[model samples]
Target: MAVHSSDYPFSAFPSPLTTSPKVPNPESQTPSPAAAAAAAHGGSAKKRKSGLIECQEPQGGGNSAGESSLDLISWLPDEVLGTVISLLPTKDGARTQAVSRRWRPLWRAAPLNLGASSDLTDQDQKRLVFVSKILSDHPGPARRFSLPCMRLRDRYAKINGWLRSQTLTGLEEIQFGYEIEDPLLHYPLPPSALRFAPTLRIAYFGYCDFPREMAPLLKFPCLKQLNLCGVIVLEDVLHSLLCGCPVLESLLLEGNVGVGCLRINSPTLRSIGISVSCYGTRVENPILLQDLIIEDAPCLERLLPLYPIRGPLTIRVVRAPKLEISGWLSDSITKLHIGTTVFQKMIALSLTTSMRSTVKVLALDTFGPNLDSVVDFLKCFPCLQKLYIKADLQKSRKNKWSYNPLDPIECLESHLRQVVVMKYWGMRPDVDFAKFFVLNAKVLKKMVFGCINNCNDNWMANQHRRLQLDNKASQGVEFKFRRGSCSISLTHSRHKQDDPFDSHIFADDA
Candidate 1:
């Protein structure tokens, strides 16, 4: 759903403008009150004036409705308009002063949103100099400060100076040290950033050169969410960082983890997302984690490896019985050690692994949509209820759903209720995979298909007939088909503000 603005998009007054004012909605009918008055009262000006005397006269123009042609925005109070301007980029926000006299003081008075590149026109200008000027001009109390590190190759001290500036005195959220556009942009953690340790609630930084032997007392008491992407910190320093955040709830570790194996033992932590390399991309001097052992996370609920874009990772759960949802499980995973069972390459190899009755929601990022491997997972997770699968056909063509009708998987027969299949191209392989649930999932309540490759009217008809929806085992199951994809990927960041497992947030990222 998109927000709508009541004011017209065009300027209030225009030269050679016609009497027919522009109406934003083509379906809406806006009658000019003045024109109607002329027709109804036989051009009686006195009667129209008497009827609408209390209404303010439109100063300049309006739509063809014979109402005020005013911009309507100028009528908003200073605080409301200032807040809107404050949310804009620094360059655009400052330019709002040119709108009118009422807007001149709003930008400077409102909270500062300083992005160094904004408002700078000269390509040759030094990054530090331009950022410094903005800080010097704006008053204290910054909301968000972003410094993009391009090929300028600036020193870390530049960022240190910005963090120390008075403009960001009480600022809490900071994203610095690295730039995604320049993957090679690595910098050492500046000492100035520790100033916000007591106040920061959310923080993100990458490509940092962590100093050895972090002080025993370093901490972030207010931080609830943290991301150290590509920040290669040693095992001891990583331990100190986690210990300091006594209330930290979410953590994201991307590539360059700088540790071979990680042991987590947090009381308040609830969510953890790791992104590692799945396709063996050659990352320069990458130090990715191979093993993640949750020794004791009592409050943990979600353990997600959003994507395999970073490097290989193997997860072993030691004591997170509260862990309810986990995945984006793909080929990048070397092992998933839960209880006594060991799952490698999307299939359980060890029969000794105990059943995971606590795991209710499972997400799979599979290349083949291989139901045979999924059946093995069902045997391990008998109580699983919600399944989110993003299946592709480019690879893993060898595995097939070779289950016999006489035998049954525990999840398919009773527990599995809601199944969401993403990026489904209704080919023979996909049709067979989906039809399996329609015929076998006796307790199924809803099945959502996001089809793209073959989604025309005729294709949908063919899929409907092939799926045999009429004979679905679940009597009242809701079968929905739409032309799109869903997100099975999860990344812990402010960029994705909502819960990663939310169905409302899904779209093609899978």
Candidate 2:
């Protein structure tokens, strides 16, 4: 249950072990600045713990400014320089004030960011004392604040004081979680938590319980993204929270959510990611997210199941007119309902969705080589253009993948343009599975096989013979092969990668 750098949504900030963000040398970044900062890193015990203060001036003294001699960074426009300092770590950002008279006012004028980690010190008392000092020093209009993981039951008063700081009036993002030791972890959701809700754009809460009674009192007009990673809230409270965030675009309900079902009815919601992750635990019977019904989400584009859940989770899509998913769909879903069509147990019982053109890009995580399901899905999504399949390397059914030439798939014949398969171990079933596409897909332009094992000249020739590439259906098809496998890493990072579900995370060695 311990928190690591990865646990934090924005891994760049608030890490006790992290160094100050690398500041550039005016024109372009060289390796020199980072090395210099590393060599000269020194500050208060708190700042030293966070590995900050490259500007490393004494706490509040500017008379000894070595920076006064070579002042290239200070030449930047006040607006530009202030922004640069604002993005630095709290200790580093605060340290810049001591560099020179030019830098002193800049730190106070720039929007503030305050971050504390549980590991910042051996005791929360010492960390709170340092945080209290920063609160009293900074003036106003804070940008983001991340409250370190702590037991809310004991430190709620301290958190209240921090939230009540005059500096955080225009706060944009805030994150907090309750320590498992809190006996009253769920009840009386901190009243000061929503002090700047109107201005908040992103909120991440963990291990807390939402009170349905207080839902009517909430309104987050500017909230765009809300992530309640590990929490327990009643079904109505969940819907009520969505109602309050009238403009929320991205919603993630991850980590063994204790809700009977999640029914979304939002006009502005764009994407939803759900996962039941019990990576390390000994809960006798943990609650899991059950049914996900899109009662009405006209603007919704993507429905992502980020982590593979062990239990059944039915997804009934009543209305998601613009949904375009890539690689987040597979057998993990107990049942899938796209419009009027029903896809259960990898069989298409009906093909009645009028929004057949909605799914242009799809990525499927087949537990194993389940070709029939892929074919069935093609029937459901006939207008798909890009298809990415990550299948298990285990031996599939002995029967060959059979699809009638007389009965054509719409996407394979006319629409489907690219096909990429990851973890392609060239066993007997793997050959049968891939050769079918090579022999049939008439409009397929590219076929990429990400093989698990490395191949030599002789091995490549043997596999080429098995797939019968010489007699392929598409004359202009470009086939490629590469070693290693890939799967999407669902870890959230607001700064580096905006979309958690994108294929940007996949690489040769991943």
> Highest TM-score among the candidates is held by which one?
2
TM-score of each: 0.71, 0.79
Model 2 weakest lDDT span, ten residues long: 9-18
Whole-model lDDT per candidate: 0.66, 0.68
| Per-residue alpha-carbon lDDT of candidate 2 for residues 338-381, written as tens digits (9 for 90 to 100) | 78888775567787764667878777777556777788788788
What candidate 1 gets wrong by more than 4 Å, as runs, is 1-88, 92-110, 117-128, 150-156, 179-186, 213-215, 277-285, 309-311, 350-358, 392-415, 422-432, 450-466, 480-510
Candidate 2 regions off by >4 Å?
1-77, 118-126, 151-153, 179-189, 277-286, 310-312, 393-406, 494-510
Residue-level lDDT tens digits of model 1 in 1-510:
221221211113223222322222222132222222233344334433443456654323333333333233433445555556556655555555544444456667877777664233334244455566678778857777765443335655666777898888766677765543454444567767667777788777766666665536677888898887767677777888888999999898776556777889999998888766411232455566778899999888888876754434578888887777877777668787887788887778885754466778888877678877777777788888888878876543543465566887788788899888888887777777788888888899989887776467788788889999999989979887766776445645422433355556333322
Cα lDDT, model 2, residue 386 = 82
- Which lDDT value does model 1 have at 197? 75
